[model samples]
Target: MLPRSGDVLHVTRAASVQFLRPITFRVIRVLDWPTYDGWLWLDGYELNASGDAVSRRSIFVQREGLHQVQTAPQHRPHTVRTARRPVARTPVRVG
Candidate 1:
Protein backbone atom coordinates (compact mmCIF):
# COMPACT_ATOMS: atom_id res chain seq x y z
CA MET A 1 0.00 0.00 0.00
CA LEU A 2 1.19 3.54 -0.78
CA PRO A 3 1.98 5.46 2.40
CA ARG A 4 0.60 8.94 3.11
CA SER A 5 1.37 11.67 5.55
CA GLY A 6 0.89 10.63 9.20
CA ASP A 7 1.07 6.95 8.36
CA VAL A 8 3.08 4.70 10.67
CA LEU A 9 5.08 1.93 9.06
CA HIS A 10 7.05 -1.11 10.16
CA VAL A 11 10.28 -0.95 8.17
CA THR A 12 12.29 -4.13 7.97
CA ARG A 13 14.72 -6.00 5.73
CA ALA A 14 11.82 -6.77 3.43
CA ALA A 15 11.61 -3.06 2.64
CA SER A 16 15.32 -2.53 2.17
CA VAL A 17 18.63 -4.26 2.89
CA GLN A 18 19.81 -1.15 4.71
CA PHE A 19 17.27 -1.86 7.43
CA LEU A 20 18.80 -4.97 8.94
CA ARG A 21 17.44 -3.75 12.23
CA PRO A 22 13.72 -3.01 11.91
CA ILE A 23 12.32 0.38 12.75
CA THR A 24 8.98 2.01 13.49
CA PHE A 25 8.56 4.99 11.19
CA ARG A 26 6.01 7.77 11.07
CA VAL A 27 5.67 9.30 7.61
CA ILE A 28 5.92 13.04 7.23
CA ARG A 29 5.56 13.00 3.44
CA VAL A 30 6.33 10.98 0.36
CA LEU A 31 9.12 12.47 -1.73
CA ASP A 32 8.33 13.04 -5.41
CA TRP A 33 11.89 12.46 -6.59
CA PRO A 34 12.04 10.09 -9.54
CA THR A 35 13.36 6.61 -8.97
CA TYR A 36 13.16 3.04 -10.34
CA ASP A 37 9.72 1.46 -10.49
CA GLY A 38 8.44 -0.18 -7.25
CA TRP A 39 10.89 1.94 -5.25
CA LEU A 40 10.37 5.36 -3.72
CA TRP A 41 11.78 7.86 -1.26
CA LEU A 42 10.13 8.72 2.04
CA ASP A 43 10.77 11.56 4.43
CA GLY A 44 9.69 10.82 7.99
CA TYR A 45 10.66 10.28 11.58
CA GLU A 46 12.09 7.14 13.13
CA LEU A 47 9.82 6.20 16.02
CA ASN A 48 10.85 4.43 19.19
CA ALA A 49 9.03 1.60 20.95
CA SER A 50 7.07 4.14 22.98
CA GLY A 51 5.71 5.44 19.61
CA ASP A 52 7.62 8.69 19.92
CA ALA A 53 9.76 10.03 17.06
CA VAL A 54 13.48 9.84 17.72
CA SER A 55 14.95 11.37 14.56
CA ARG A 56 14.01 12.64 11.12
CA ARG A 57 15.32 10.81 8.07
CA SER A 58 14.89 10.14 4.38
CA ILE A 59 14.52 6.51 3.37
CA PHE A 60 14.46 4.58 0.12
CA VAL A 61 12.55 1.32 0.01
CA GLN A 62 10.40 -0.88 -2.17
CA ARG A 63 6.70 -0.10 -2.23
CA GLU A 64 5.75 -3.77 -2.16
CA GLY A 65 7.71 -4.28 1.06
CA LEU A 66 6.33 -1.39 3.07
CA HIS A 67 4.14 -2.49 5.96
CA GLN A 68 1.55 -0.17 7.47
CA VAL A 69 0.82 -0.32 11.17
CA GLN A 70 -2.77 -0.09 12.37
CA THR A 71 -3.33 2.33 15.18
CA ALA A 72 -5.67 1.57 18.09
CA PRO A 73 -8.90 3.55 18.33
CA GLN A 74 -9.09 6.01 21.20
CA HIS A 75 -11.72 5.39 23.88
CA ARG A 76 -13.43 8.24 25.75
CA PRO A 77 -15.58 7.76 28.84
CA HIS A 78 -19.16 9.03 28.53
CA THR A 79 -20.89 10.46 31.61
CA VAL A 80 -24.19 12.22 32.39
CA ARG A 81 -24.79 14.71 35.21
CA THR A 82 -27.98 16.40 36.40
CA ALA A 83 -28.21 20.16 36.25
CA ARG A 84 -28.47 22.02 39.54
CA ARG A 85 -31.26 24.52 40.25
CA PRO A 86 -30.34 28.14 40.87
CA VAL A 87 -30.39 29.33 44.49
CA ALA A 88 -32.97 31.97 45.51
CA ARG A 89 -31.78 35.30 46.95
CA THR A 90 -33.59 37.28 49.75
CA PRO A 91 -34.25 41.02 49.18
CA VAL A 92 -33.17 43.40 52.03
CA ARG A 93 -34.75 46.84 52.77
CA VAL A 94 -32.32 49.75 52.35
CA GLY A 95 -32.53 52.95 54.51
Candidate 2:
Protein backbone atom coordinates (compact mmCIF):
# COMPACT_ATOMS: atom_id res chain seq x y z
CA MET A 1 0.00 0.00 0.00
CA LEU A 2 1.15 3.49 -0.81
CA PRO A 3 1.11 6.20 1.79
CA ARG A 4 -0.78 9.40 1.11
CA SER A 5 -0.15 12.91 2.29
CA GLY A 6 -0.71 13.86 5.95
CA ASP A 7 0.06 10.34 7.10
CA VAL A 8 2.24 9.83 10.14
CA LEU A 9 5.00 7.31 9.71
CA HIS A 10 7.45 5.77 12.16
CA VAL A 11 10.75 5.44 10.38
CA THR A 12 13.27 3.01 11.82
CA ARG A 13 17.00 3.63 12.02
CA ALA A 14 17.69 0.47 10.07
CA ALA A 15 16.09 2.20 7.11
CA SER A 16 17.78 5.52 7.75
CA VAL A 17 21.17 6.79 6.81
CA GLN A 18 22.38 8.85 9.80
CA PHE A 19 19.82 8.41 12.52
CA LEU A 20 20.67 5.32 14.57
CA ARG A 21 17.27 5.15 16.20
CA PRO A 22 13.62 4.97 15.40
CA ILE A 23 12.14 8.26 14.30
CA THR A 24 8.57 9.24 13.85
CA PHE A 25 7.79 11.06 10.62
CA ARG A 26 4.92 12.20 8.49
CA VAL A 27 4.41 11.65 4.82
CA ILE A 28 4.65 15.03 3.17
CA ARG A 29 4.57 13.87 -0.42
CA VAL A 30 5.14 10.79 -2.51
CA LEU A 31 7.65 11.14 -5.33
CA ASP A 32 6.97 7.87 -7.05
CA TRP A 33 4.70 4.86 -6.58
CA PRO A 34 5.69 1.87 -8.62
CA THR A 35 4.61 -1.74 -8.54
CA TYR A 36 8.02 -2.66 -7.12
CA ASP A 37 11.09 -0.86 -5.79
CA GLY A 38 9.35 2.47 -5.50
CA TRP A 39 10.51 5.63 -3.76
CA LEU A 40 8.88 7.56 -0.93
CA TRP A 41 9.59 11.18 -0.02
CA LEU A 42 9.02 12.40 3.53
CA ASP A 43 9.73 15.47 5.61
CA GLY A 44 9.78 15.98 9.35
CA TYR A 45 11.82 17.30 12.24
CA GLU A 46 15.00 15.53 13.10
CA LEU A 47 14.92 13.60 16.33
CA ASN A 48 17.81 12.74 18.60
CA ALA A 49 18.60 9.34 20.05
CA SER A 50 16.37 10.20 22.96
CA GLY A 51 13.47 10.70 20.56
CA ASP A 52 13.51 14.44 21.11
CA ALA A 53 12.45 16.70 18.28
CA VAL A 54 15.23 18.92 17.09
CA SER A 55 15.17 22.41 15.66
CA ARG A 56 15.94 21.06 12.24
CA ARG A 57 12.81 21.19 10.15
CA SER A 58 11.99 20.14 6.60
CA ILE A 59 13.95 16.95 6.88
CA PHE A 60 13.44 15.11 3.60
CA VAL A 61 13.93 11.39 3.22
CA GLN A 62 13.56 9.60 -0.07
CA ARG A 63 14.46 6.49 -2.09
CA GLU A 64 15.01 3.09 -0.50
CA GLY A 65 16.90 4.64 2.36
CA LEU A 66 13.81 5.59 4.27
CA HIS A 67 11.06 3.24 5.40
CA GLN A 68 7.55 4.09 6.49
CA VAL A 69 6.06 2.91 9.77
CA GLN A 70 2.88 1.82 8.10
CA THR A 71 1.43 1.83 4.65
CA ALA A 72 -1.13 4.57 4.46
CA PRO A 73 -4.43 4.01 2.75
CA GLN A 74 -4.20 4.61 -0.97
CA HIS A 75 -6.25 7.59 -1.99
CA ARG A 76 -7.37 6.77 -5.47
CA PRO A 77 -8.27 9.72 -7.58
CA HIS A 78 -11.74 9.78 -9.12
CA THR A 79 -11.53 9.22 -12.86
CA VAL A 80 -14.86 9.23 -14.58
CA ARG A 81 -15.41 10.38 -18.12
CA THR A 82 -18.76 11.88 -19.00
CA ALA A 83 -20.30 11.12 -22.37
CA ARG A 84 -21.78 13.87 -24.48
CA ARG A 85 -25.31 13.50 -25.77
CA PRO A 86 -26.24 14.32 -29.35
CA VAL A 87 -28.23 17.47 -29.88
CA ALA A 88 -31.34 17.71 -32.06
CA ARG A 89 -31.03 19.71 -35.25
CA THR A 90 -33.71 22.30 -36.13
CA PRO A 91 -34.61 23.16 -39.74
CA VAL A 92 -34.06 26.83 -40.62
CA ARG A 93 -36.93 28.86 -42.31
CA VAL A 94 -35.66 30.56 -45.44
CA GLY A 95 -37.53 33.69 -46.66
Candidate 3:
Protein backbone atom coordinates (compact mmCIF):
# COMPACT_ATOMS: atom_id res chain seq x y z
CA MET A 1 0.00 0.00 0.00
CA LEU A 2 1.14 3.56 -0.73
CA PRO A 3 1.89 5.28 2.54
CA ARG A 4 0.53 8.78 3.08
CA SER A 5 1.29 11.46 5.65
CA GLY A 6 0.40 10.48 9.26
CA ASP A 7 0.46 6.74 8.45
CA VAL A 8 2.08 4.51 11.04
CA LEU A 9 4.04 1.46 9.91
CA HIS A 10 5.82 -1.53 11.40
CA VAL A 11 9.13 -1.74 9.56
CA THR A 12 11.15 -4.91 9.69
CA ARG A 13 13.81 -6.90 7.81
CA ALA A 14 11.16 -7.98 5.34
CA ALA A 15 10.97 -4.39 4.13
CA SER A 16 14.74 -4.12 3.66
CA VAL A 17 18.03 -5.67 4.80
CA GLN A 18 19.09 -2.43 6.47
CA PHE A 19 16.31 -2.84 9.00
CA LEU A 20 17.70 -5.82 10.89
CA ARG A 21 15.93 -4.42 13.94
CA PRO A 22 12.26 -3.60 13.61
CA ILE A 23 10.91 -0.10 14.21
CA THR A 24 7.58 1.70 14.48
CA PHE A 25 7.55 4.51 11.94
CA ARG A 26 5.21 7.45 11.41
CA VAL A 27 5.20 8.72 7.84
CA ILE A 28 5.85 12.42 7.28
CA ARG A 29 5.42 12.01 3.53
CA VAL A 30 6.24 9.56 0.74
CA LEU A 31 9.27 10.50 -1.32
CA ASP A 32 8.86 10.70 -5.09
CA TRP A 33 12.42 9.68 -5.91
CA PRO A 34 12.81 7.00 -8.57
CA THR A 35 13.49 3.45 -7.43
CA TYR A 36 13.52 -0.14 -8.65
CA ASP A 37 10.16 -1.77 -9.28
CA GLY A 38 8.34 -2.85 -6.05
CA TRP A 39 10.64 -0.60 -3.99
CA LEU A 40 10.06 2.90 -2.61
CA TRP A 41 11.74 5.64 -0.60
CA LEU A 42 9.82 6.95 2.40
CA ASP A 43 10.41 10.07 4.49
CA GLY A 44 9.27 9.60 8.10
CA TYR A 45 10.12 9.36 11.77
CA GLU A 46 11.17 6.48 13.99
CA LEU A 47 8.59 6.02 16.72
CA ASN A 48 9.14 4.54 20.16
CA ALA A 49 6.94 1.94 21.83
CA SER A 50 4.86 4.74 23.37
CA GLY A 51 4.20 5.96 19.78
CA ASP A 52 6.27 9.11 20.17
CA ALA A 53 8.67 10.14 17.40
CA VAL A 54 12.30 9.58 18.38
CA SER A 55 14.11 10.66 15.22
CA ARG A 56 13.62 11.68 11.61
CA ARG A 57 14.78 9.36 8.80
CA SER A 58 14.35 8.31 5.23
CA ILE A 59 13.90 4.59 4.47
CA PHE A 60 14.07 2.42 1.39
CA VAL A 61 11.87 -0.66 1.32
CA GLN A 62 9.81 -2.96 -0.84
CA ARG A 63 6.20 -1.91 -1.12
CA GLU A 64 4.99 -5.47 -0.66
CA GLY A 65 6.91 -5.76 2.61
CA LEU A 66 5.62 -2.58 4.26
CA HIS A 67 2.94 -3.14 6.92
CA GLN A 68 0.49 -0.50 8.02
CA VAL A 69 -0.40 -0.16 11.68
CA GLN A 70 -4.01 0.12 12.80
CA THR A 71 -4.60 3.07 15.12
CA ALA A 72 -7.00 2.90 18.10
CA PRO A 73 -10.38 4.61 18.01
CA GLN A 74 -10.61 8.14 19.40
CA HIS A 75 -11.61 8.53 23.07
CA ARG A 76 -15.07 9.81 24.07
CA PRO A 77 -15.40 13.42 25.20
CA HIS A 78 -15.83 14.14 28.93
CA THR A 79 -19.22 15.35 30.21
CA VAL A 80 -19.41 18.87 31.68
CA ARG A 81 -20.70 19.30 35.28
CA THR A 82 -22.61 22.36 36.50
CA ALA A 83 -21.62 23.65 39.98
CA ARG A 84 -24.26 24.76 42.49
CA ARG A 85 -23.96 28.15 44.31
CA PRO A 86 -24.31 28.51 48.12
CA VAL A 87 -27.41 30.37 49.54
CA ALA A 88 -26.79 33.90 50.99
CA ARG A 89 -27.90 34.78 54.58
CA THR A 90 -29.12 38.20 55.88
CA PRO A 91 -27.19 39.98 58.74
CA VAL A 92 -28.88 40.75 62.15
CA ARG A 93 -29.18 44.46 63.32
CA VAL A 94 -27.07 45.61 66.35
CA GLY A 95 -28.75 47.32 69.44
Best candidate according to lDDT = 1
Per-residue lDDT of candidate 2, residues 2-26 (tens digit): 5566555566554546556666765
> Once all C-alphas are superposed, what RMSD does model 1 give against the true structure?
7.4
CA deviation > 4 Å runs, candidate 3: 71-95
Count backbone clashes in candidate 1. Answer: 0
- On residues 1-95, what C-alpha lDDT tens digit does candidate 3 reach at each position? 88888889999999999989999998888899999999989998999999888999999999989889954345579999899798898998999
Compared with the true structure, what per-residue lDDT tens digits does model 1 show for residues 19-94? 9999999888889999999998999999999998899999999999888995434556887889989999999899
Please give the distance, in angstroms, between residue 88's alpha carbon in candidate 3 and its true position after superposition.
Answer: 38
Best by TM-score: 1
After superposition, candidate 1 runs with Cα above 4 Å error: 71-95
Worst 10 residues of 2 by lDDT: 32-41
Name every residue pair that clashes in candidate 3.
none
Which window of ten consecutive residues has the lowest lDDT sum in model 3? 67-76
